[model samples]
Target: MNLSKFDFTRLKNLLPSSLKSLSINPTSDLIREDENNDTEFYSTPRFVHHIDDRARYVLSQFYTYAIQQTPETITLDLCSSWTSHLPENFIGKVFGLGMNELELKENPSLNQGYTVQDLNQNPSLPKFSSNTFDSVICSVSIDYLIHPLKIFNEVGRILKPNGLFITSFSNRCFPTKVIRKWLYMNELQRVEWVANYFLQTDTYFNPMTIKAYSFFDGNFLPITDEHYVDPMYIVSANKK
Candidate 1:
């Protein structure tokens, strides 16, 4: 997969001009937050999904199918929130870990556990037993995480050797909460950034099987959909 497996065919032209390679931005212009850091950030809970309706449908479709690919057993949704897009009959146990108590409470899908783990200050996740889960799913919140390498490393630590991590995100995000490093990266660079997360941690992620899909597939959702999107990135990396 040495980077080639990341199918950006549908996204080559759409990639933001600002990014074209593995370049790093040492400055914090694009990274700068107009919002004041005085706020505790997640002090208030957001009980809503980030993407529009159309995007949500597409996101749901991905979730429904992803469940089929993996076994019906233990699953972890790190940086998880209320309303995880799991199939009705997933036959697996779903564990959600996020910041908001109200949001997690609203999610009827959470089986028994709802833990909170933030990656900005503490990169280490709470649950640990080494390769314990069959799947690790992160929804549209990947951009919000500052230390992806650390998070991904912890993901690898929790996932069973053959388990997979489904990291998906769209163009929409909370500007201030997202890290400066991610804010500066374009689509292609974003993919590389995520892949490099696995690389940096020396995880067992299989790059050869890595793939990216833009939701712009033939069927476009009505403009009324809640999600905001130009392109999407969904990658599945298997734990070796």
Candidate 2:
């Protein structure tokens, strides 16, 4: 099925009005995970793609569209790994920040440069100067954030005015590492959770858009019964 033709209303209706009003203490167990040491957990290099190929293609298409929409000069892939799912002929330089050193070094997508740092330990992007990147992307890794507010603020600081920050996620994740708040909420609420991350930071422009592109329906079954494909959703905002 064509991506544009996919019905998102069913998913949209699941979002609660009180989602934005919801709050949790940053140190609460709701955001904590079974494995606290992210560095240790990510020590072993896992080169595998978290989402399936079709989902990856869908995400890459969205990334391409976002890049074209904003026309980035330089991009940063936060919590990135071996693959960024970027368009093949992307014009701008792409940098990666990840936990595993070997994974960052091996990533073909980070043609420009790459660094290894645990954002949980130091939520601040001290390595990069202020206003350095035109675009920032965090793909499928938002649920793993323990200090999302601080990280989002850092993203806003690093982004130039009017720059875009695109965050995308799917149904799949390492459950043990995913935060309790993320695990408990359904997909639609998870979308709002990301949006709230942007809103509460007060560093990005308002009216952030939440979008969904699913190969499956409300039942979590594939529309075409093609190999199971994970649904993709994005929440995006511009730096003020």
- Compare the candidates by TM-score and give the number of the best one: 2
User: Candidate 2 versus the native: TM-score?
Assistant: 0.86
By summed lDDT, which 10 consecutive residues of candidate 2 come out lowest?
7-16
Best by lDDT: 2
RMSD of 1: 6.5
Candidate 2 local distance difference test against the native: 0.77
lDDT of 2 by residue, 111-153 (tens): 7888899998889998888888888999999998888888999
lDDT of 1 by residue, 116-153 (tens): 75566677876568878888888888877655667788
Q: For residue 43, give model 1's deviation from the true position in Å.
A: 2.5
CA-lDDT, candidates in order: 0.66, 0.77
For all candidates, what are the clash counts? 8, 0
Displacement of residue 84 (Cα, Å) in model 2 is: 0.6
